[model samples]
Target: MFGNDVRLKLKMACRLLGGQKSVANSAHIDNSNFGKWLKGQPTLSEENIQAVLTAMGLPDGEPDTKNIHCWNIKNSFLNNLSSALSLYFPYTAEMARAPWVVQGPSLKDTLGIGDAPNTLYALTDGKTRAILRMPRSVIIQENNVLPVIKWRNDTPEKSVLLIEEIKSGWVTGVPTVKEFDLAWNAQGHQVTDHDVLQAIKDADISNKEAVRRIKQKK
Candidate 1:
């Protein structure tokens, strides 16, 4: 699924940017190799994924785990999250009044909930929407309220929740979402959670400095 999504996204990127030739040049992979890679032939290394994303002019850096609303996970994770979100926030004539979906991964990997490699998604009702994703393993057993508090207070951009599923004495993380101020902007500037996560991923800053800078901007 990852390979397939990458291929489709690459094709879309090519068309958006220019043509096949331009995409080939930007991705630094020959057309034949690119085709092979897309077919699950394993032509490119994992490192090349970043190259493809960069060529498409998407964000470049480590995947953010905090915002969960913008973290890119494996395709399987995304599919599951999308299904769960649609279920939780079912679309109806009244709900369909708004017609846009903002999908992405979160900033933190496991919002202290169940396991690693959890993906996130956000859906809005024009004013605000929910931010949801799976949590880490340790978080599944401990008190969940702390992460919830952190998510609410520290993440001024939205209100969110951490979710986990425990069954038969075993815990499994699942996609979670909660209300957030989708239209809110910091410092009178419109910055999506993706933008903030990207900045955090790309910038080289200490914990103290990072906090100071983010606050200063706000």
Candidate 2:
């Protein structure tokens, strides 16, 4: 599924950037290797994937694009659909669990979004995790004057949930407790439930109501 998703995205990237040759040149990847990727003659590498995204002027992140086949944006601030299309990327599942910084094209002038911040953090929790649980791509949009993310369901019913972005980027998916523990330990702070809750509060990615609900669930 990941391969197919990469192929699908690669084809689309090539089209948007011009063609296979253009992509190869822009990404600085060898033409033969690029062709091999298209033909499935060899396995796709992280390096090539990053190169493709770089050529496309998208953020460089380890987004699991393979699990996602389609993405649909609703009520986007950007007037140009093509420009909005560049917003989609396969973020790693772990990155999805917490807020992380991502750099991309300045979205300010494009739709009055504002200037590129010296640093910006993406929120990757709550509804973003729910969507990934369904194993689908997310739809990016704005709600209540904040960036909201939701699952892009491809079914006929098209059930979706729109939640505010963790900060800006949505989580790729949930992470295991062990992974969470490792992350906490790596932070070099004494681990405690209070500490974890405090960290979440400091991040400001999860809504107060949502956080309250989560605590209640626990």
Candidate 3:
């Protein structure tokens, strides 16, 4: 329901967030231009409007249709990760070694998603805080250690689904195709975005159903 009025939406969003600066940071708008927009000198672009909606958690608008889909992908990632962890049980403690994707200043910087002027997610687990190492990437300058969750007795189907969700999240929300390829390759996939996406799409059928049946058996 995002109508043709960019200024109105922006003003309302700013009020919702308490001010222009907060909205600007969340929308990834830099200071100078954000001031300009507030002053009515230059309006936001279509792409920027969508970015703002995504940042404001207002994905209910028409501009955020793709974002809604991306959010769903992220949720699926969390659910699947949880399922995998459940299977790992006594062997897998949610203690220190559980690797989960998070939104934060450090992660955004590490993932090369640009500065957002705030840390949206914080690692609060005491045990995880004791042992977490920032991921090393040849591309990303941030020292944020990559968190990798290790689990035993994992299935290929589960693995594929997990990666799919992860990749899809980046593809739809944050990273570029080249960035996606580089990140996954650094994680040792050695595959392009096209390759991974195709694999994800292919795995949507028999393999997933088979995994569901296997889980049911268990």
**Which tens-of-lDDT digit does each residue in 79-186 have in candidate 1?**
123222222223410111111111234334324333433333333433223333333211111122222122222332332322222221112232322222322221
User: Model 1 residue 54 lDDT?
Assistant: 59
Which lDDT tens digits does candidate 2 get at residues 1-218?
33654565556545434567887898888877877777666645778867776665543633333222222222223333232232343231112222221212334423435433122112223212212211112222323112233222222122212223342323443334333333323423336988867777887757676578678999
For model 1, what is the alpha-carbon lDDT of residue 1? 37
lDDT of 3 by residue, 149-204 (tens): 33111321122111333443332344443443333333334468787557656777
C-alpha positional error of residue 107 in candidate 1 after TM-score superposition, expressed in Å:
49
Task: Single out the weakest 10-residue window by summed lDDT for candidate 3.
Answer: 68-77
**CA lDDT for candidate 2:** 0.40
Please, what is the whole-model Cα lDDT of each candidate in the order they appear?
Answer: 0.38, 0.40, 0.36
* Candidate 2, residue 186: lDDT: 44
The total number of steric clashes, by the backbone 3 Å criterion, in model 2 comes to 11
Model 3 ranges with Cα > 4 A deviation: 1-6, 63-218
Find the candidate with the highest TM-score and give its number: 2
Q: Which segments of candidate 1 are over 4 A away from where they belong?
A: 59-218
